[model samples]
Target: MLNYLGDKKDERMKMRNRYRKSTALRCDAGSRCLISVVIGSLMGCILLLNLYSAIRPADEIGQHIHLRTSHHLHFPELEEVEEENIQIPPPRKRSPRATKRRPKKTTTLIDEFLDEDSQIRHKFFPDQKTSIDPMITGNDSMFYYPGRVWLDTEGNPIQAHGGGVLFDERSETYYWYGEYKDGPTYHAHKKGAARVDIIGVGCYSSKDLWTWKNEGIVLTAEETDETHDLHKSNVLERPKVIYNSRTRKYVMWMHIDDVNYTKASVGVAISDYPTGPFDYLYSKRPHGCDSRDMTIFKDDDGTAYLIYSSEDNSELHVGSLSEDYLDVTNVARRILIGQHREAPALFKHQGTYYMVTSGCTGWAPNEALTHAAESIMGPWETMGNPCMGGNKMFRLATFFSQSTFVLPVPSYPNLFIFMADRWNPADLRDSRYLWLPLMVGGLVDEPLDYNFGFPLWSRVSIYWHRKWRLPQGWNSLK
Candidate 1:
């Protein structure tokens, strides 16, 4: 009996050992399977995230949510396409003496535009009877009638031409700086371009951009110094001002040239106040290159850049400014090479940089091309003309205007005021301001040269309007 009990216990012990081994193996297999599943899921999620990032638009990837929303908003009123069909009248009979002085050639709409005696001159330059007098309290109080005479608070025509707006945060006012070309216009020589003697840079202050209060000639011409850069015989155009926080100074940059336009250089000036008696510092060719048709852009980080037409206006050169905002740095890059462009007006949206430039067609208006880059110092890609809502000829001629500065409307993301000069070569002081709506949103109309199967940036559209105003409650947002 004892022997039989011992055998049974031994067999039961053996069976229990085998059962424990099997249970241990099963638990090991289950743990391994769970770990594999977790690892696979994690890998799959990472792969999807990489794919999404790769497909997303570069400009949109790191953009702010509010900016994205603002850009996508449908501003139908501002974007409304208004067509203008201007009919060129038949040529008037000229006297034999007049015909002998000037031979008649193929006359296009542009030809009529340059002619001071054009039969449709009234169409381009409306008489003073239709002037935008801000002092007048009526239905036209704040409405902007583009192409009409814009009078200051004193009832004189605003002399800010080829100008730029500087928002002074401390005073919360907009200071407009430009060539104060209020003098008589004439050609320096028989073969020279139409010009007005330097009267120094004009500054105008405004709470609302429509109603300007003249700040007088902030930077006065050097009357006695014939060799001065600001001498009456010299040329000073496109004066842009930006405030430097570090230096606590308002710095101005302008295109300074001789009467023959042979000395293409940039002049620098500094002011203690926004409405300034700016002190003229000096002038130099930036990067040792002949610079003209220049503009200064102050970036969000307080860094500033100078962009100018170089290589005899065959290309554009961009360089950073010294910390003092007084001079250009050694870092420079040539952009839009061999593509003769001038009248550069640059603005940033989201993470992309955009520039509106005109062909090097002297004072006459030409097609405006918009270029974009991921960087400011760029390998810029031309995005074709941004003009919209005009007739074919109007669009082709940039609405008979040249870009000077692009002002971003406060509190309105992606919405900017396209400030251009409808230059009257015959009378530079009579130049009209074309402040139209410029928006950045839709895909580019023209395929880029190196987009690699996807569009790189948003389309820049400057909508044309015979007359347009900012949306209601624009100032309230500020």
Candidate 2:
């Protein structure tokens, strides 16, 4: 009876050992299964992320496409616009000399600025009253007195007219460059339009967007040399700059033509420095085609492209610049053909390309059109004028100005500074700069083929304000 009891006990112990081994194996299998599932999930998520980035448009297009310039600009790229940085200074105190004497009948500054015959005309022009004094404190502190003669740090009127701004990141400063129209303005031919002798490109730098220091004429026209491409009598308007990382040089492109604008070609210039005496290389009909009213855009990935109104102002051509950022590559595509558009200011929001253009009218305000494209090349869709808030006349007239440039305020989303020129054809020197608030919002007024039934982009509206500054926080981020 004792032996039989002992055998039964041994059998029970073996059974218990077997059960323990089985439980341990099961736990190991479960852990392996869980690890496999976790790894698979992680890999799947990474794949989806890559695919999403590939499809996202905004990821591809950067802040407003950067215009051409001659500097290693390292300004941080902005994705949205905020209110402008406008700090109004305190009122000015009368100088002791002026306080000691009876104030000559206080003619209003605006009246004196507008009156061509006023004795203070010189004050508003080349004289001291309206002269842009960088050293002046008080009301003039960091104020852009529009229509007032803006003097450089050298106390000379900055010659950058119809110009564009290039934010240089490397130096943490902004460079203002444009046509230096210093020469006298006159009619080119018996029936030709009024024009000034080409004076090349003017460069100015500003830390605070208001106070500008002149860098001098970076590209000066050939004064007495008629054979030169930049001959003083020739046409050189709307000079734009871009940096070419490949070539390691600043490339400039401008609208080069004769007195009658018969030489319908784009001129190219190069400089090693931002403030430069650029070397005029040559002019060309880009892609073996006529180009006018042209501008260049540099992408975030270092790829640059050019857009020009071509085929007798009936269409536009867009082509990518070579890797070196100088000449146009063989790749060329025609967009907005037969659209009869000019004065294009292109910007990109959320990977979508947006452009503002005016009709082919000469020196007269006409209806403006805003266009968009998924790609920079072809099939651009027209989405009517983006002008809003103003009366019908203001919307149709682009606030009585022509599109020059759309400056983006860093801190504001969908808000931009619409810069235009209210050209005084009778007196070009008296031309006024019209800057309005441009906001992109609401369903587009028109339908697009790509958008199916609903509009793909928000409507673009330029609000007309008699006097306005960028909304609060526009430049606060900077």
Candidate 3:
């Protein structure tokens, strides 16, 4: 009986010990689960904060800090909405035979805009008397008069039409590149588009945006090679240059096509210097599709991309270039599909991509649309016409101009120079450059198809001005 009692007590003590060990194990597991939940919650909160910072308006987050720090960069003068009033003159009387051949349709302001003999032609293309001469230093010095003749340092009108400006960090100068259309303009066939034979790509250098020094024909046309792509009979236009840091070379890309414009392709050229006699490498149809009206953009991360009108100008394709910045990769995403956008001038701000595009209206100025995307290759949403301050007709016609490039102002957040071409189809070489202030801020005016009533992008405004200049000391911070 004594042995049995002892054994029973020992067994009871062992059972108590076992129960305590199991309870301790359960408590440890519960503590571990609580720690995991806390860590996971922290990570999720961080992700949500980052996402909010990206999509929020510039003024909401740190734009106030920028405003306080860079008060000198504030451009209240540029932000002021300047209205324009253009009176379309009465139509010229047409002859009976001319009227009979073409039935009398209701004439529009666009008709007057295209007519060389339009009474308001001077309004669109002012004569040399009111040219923007950089040499003449007075109250009007450094001011930009849009639609007026812009003379280079040599007292000759700048001939870089459909051009883009590159700010070279090494030399700290801006280089402008475009089609050298100093040659005569004519139609190749009865129905061919009016074009100036490939006189070559022109290069001009400038310390300030004003006062350009001609760099001559950087890439000349082939005079004798009838089958060559750069032959005088072919088309070469919208040449853009971007520097490759890895290769330390300047790459030039332009639209190459036949006079008939059926052979649409892009040509590439490279040079060691900004003012270049570039070697024409070759031309190709990127992704085996017809390309025209293209532009190349070098991102802040040193990656370059090519955006071109493809599939008969019904859509645009965005693709990354090779590491050397010479060729496109197999990766291509078609954005703005079926929107019929061309003249793509892309710029990024506050981690968002913005583009200004024109309609496929040939030389005639059409409505300009601004698009925004969270990613470069993305589902870009159209944000309506960016033209502001101008009258109804002026806004409708993109201020009588087509977008060529959107140049960011150094050290000035959300400020850019909107460069465009006031095309003169009758006299192609006499085209004028329209530089206006483009600001990215405020809520988007149009509702997005997605987003469920929430604003997803900022408004891109290209404010029109008859005469405007960069803020007094815009380049001082540079």
Candidate 4:
């Protein structure tokens, strides 16, 4: 009886141990178990991802290889990574007496960029005669020269700056709208920022994103009415458009300010068609707050929102527009406060919201920041600089360009086009567009987060290239 009882007790002990082991794995593993599991899962995922990525084309390398394999469409040469090793020439000698009277100061490349009569002026503002005219350029049809002057089908230089593109599904075309700064550039006062009179917003239509056809000045500035919000003496910049399916209206939202930038407001205009002489309606401080350097985003749903720099551009605010896409609703949420970020370009991917913003420096290139949020409204996290593959200085200065827009490549999950302006402050009309490839993937280079051991965000990379073109079969990239 004693032996049987001992056997039963031994069996019960084994059962108890098994139950305890399953319930509290930490007891045997010392809490390192969870981390081990995580790491193991991560490594397994990495292996699988690497295997799949090795087989996939167009994504592994920056070039679009998948399109070439299937469709056999001939695209311009995929721009190779070219680096610039420009050196600053020595300063000119001045007479000692003249130097004593007026000190000979050191000048930087930035100073050269801001000086209209600098000896290197041609380097920045190349002659428009050698422009990218798609009509006559046979083999170079889709080639994009980063700083070269770009012309439309009408043989006129494209005037769309600080622009946003809208893919019109109904018409099966893309409509791009932006500030039409075709007139001369000037400053309102000695200390004022570089200004271009409100000549109005220009629109361009394209079957492909390349080779635009000018739609003329869709929204004209008020030439006579001085009190008008769009008066020639005032400011109208960064115009973005979105179509409302519910209202069937193409609504425009732009930064409308006075010459001194004291009246910081957003103007609303609407038309029934994409190409239009839009009817200017009114301007207002959205949510009873100052708005500037703004952009409009349409969500996967019909809901659209306007995001702008507020609190004197120290922070940004996002609020949904009314169903008609005319004005802001009462609900407004502040984001990236005290970050001193401006020129927000927002886009969404796989239900996560992402934004690219520049510093508050006027007409100067600064480091670009990419932010991600689970929700569109709040608690956003900075994902560090999205620039990669350039020299350290090039990455830091955003390739000498400021964020204007982040365009998504349809059907291509992580591929995007980073559109920016290489502003020529001396003559804003000579500003050039910088279109670079932006991709989001891989472990970020920066330390992920202080609160956690690894980064929660993916690295956003903008590859630097002298000339690049979209893969011929971008839409069908599987």
Scored by lDDT, the top model is 1
Off by over 4 Å in 1: 1-71, 93-104, 452-454
lDDT of 2 by residue, 1-478 (tens): 2221245457446544643433233347659888778869997997787577447776242331222111112212221322222222333578879867956445443333344565544432344465557777775465444445566777776667666777766676777788776656688668988777787788998876567888988998888889777898888877788777667688888888888777888988999877877898999888777787878877767788888888788878788988876688877766665579988888776567789999987766778999988788756888888776445655676755688777766655566777676554545654555556676654566766333343455567676554344443445336
lDDT of 3 by residue, 151-228 (tens): 999998888888899999899999999888887878888887888888999889988898899989999999999999
**TM-score attained by model 1:** 0.84
Q: What is the Å distance of residue 6 in model 2 from its true position?
A: 99
Ranking by lDDT: 1, 3, 4, 2
Ten-residue region with minimum lDDT total, candidate 4:
67-76
Report the error of model 1 at residue 230, Å: 0.8
The global C-alpha lDDT for each of the candidates, from Candidate 1 onward, is 0.87, 0.68, 0.86, 0.80
- Candidate 3: where is the Cα deviation over 4 Å? 1-74, 93-103
> Model 1, 90: alpha-carbon shift in Å?
1.6
Candidate 4 lDDT tens digits, 1-478: 2221245457546544643524333445576777778879997987787677558765554343333233222222332356766556677878999999999777866677667787776666678876889888687888777778988998888888998988888888889898888888787899999888999999999876778999999999899999999999999989999999988899999999999999999999999999987999999998778898999999998899999999899889889999999988876677776689999999876566889999998887789988888789866778789876556766777877888888887766767788888888877777888888776655555543222333444566677887777876777223
Clashes of 3: 0
Task: Report the C-alpha displacement of residue 398, candidate 2, in angstroms.
Answer: 1.8
Q: Model 2 misses residue 405 by how many Å?
A: 1.9
Error of 2 at 145 (Å): 6.3
